[model samples]
Target: MSETLTPERVRADVAELLGCEPAEITPGENLFDRGLDSMRVMILVERWRAAGAASLEFPDLAECPELGHWTALLTGDGA
Candidate 1:
């Protein structure tokens, strides 16, 4: 289930988990500050891993709870 990881995609996924509209999720906003909990983060991690992002880890998302950062990390465009 490999697919391109884009900021839009990340935003959509995060929005789904957070029960908000994608437009409400800012690319640079901190997801944790927006109510993203550990359970949701793990759910996202598993989903991404299943989508071929095996390198993804909880801390990778936790340390940086921004959509842009997650997109870059999953897409291999950021550190």
Candidate 2:
């Protein structure tokens, strides 16, 4: 995992994965419900897990519903 997962980096990564503009993602909105399908979510989670073995916790991922939460997990600022 990166030493610190910044919000800016999260925004960029998510946008790239979704193939959309970063502004399309709201900070506190629920991304899955907003259009991030199960496949995408799984792929994202797996990617994070692969990025570093200790980089992700699937259960904690459930509580993360938006860019803010996702960024927190990636950066270890807390979930």
Candidate 3:
């Protein structure tokens, strides 16, 4: 079975790329503004997909680059 993806994991992944603590990523803040570019997003998409979020797409994140949004998408808490 694949490892379950968690909100913390999502935050940590993005934080790792940003070179900062996961807690520094505010839920509602735009990650792009925080230095997350398309290339980084593609990386997260692939990583998350490998982590069990197979349905995750680049557009799902690119259209809404927020920690909360990503967390919800990865954790299946969003509509």
Model 3 misses residue 75 by how many Å?
0.2
Instruction: Write down the RMSD of all candidates, one decimal each.
Output: 2.3, 3.1, 2.0
TM-score per prediction, in order, is: 0.86, 0.69, 0.91
Q: Candidate 2, residues 11-75: lDDT per residue as tens digits? A: 77678778889888877888877777667777767766665536565656567667877776677
In the range 13-35, model 3's lDDT, one tens digit per residue, is 99999999998888999999999
Query: Ranking by TM-score, best first?
Result: 3, 1, 2
Structure candidate 1, residue pairs in collision? none
Q: Clashes in each model (backbone N, CA, C under 3 Å)?
A: 0, 1, 0
Among the numbered candidates, top lDDT falls to 3
lDDT of 1 by residue, 1-79 (tens): 4775666667788999999999887678998899999999999999889878888899999998988789888875542
Off by over 4 Å in 2: 1-4, 53-55, 77-79
- How far out, in Å, is residue 57 in model 1? 0.6
| Colliding residue pairs in candidate 2 | 5-75
lDDT of each: 0.84, 0.69, 0.88
Residue 75 lDDT in model 3?
93
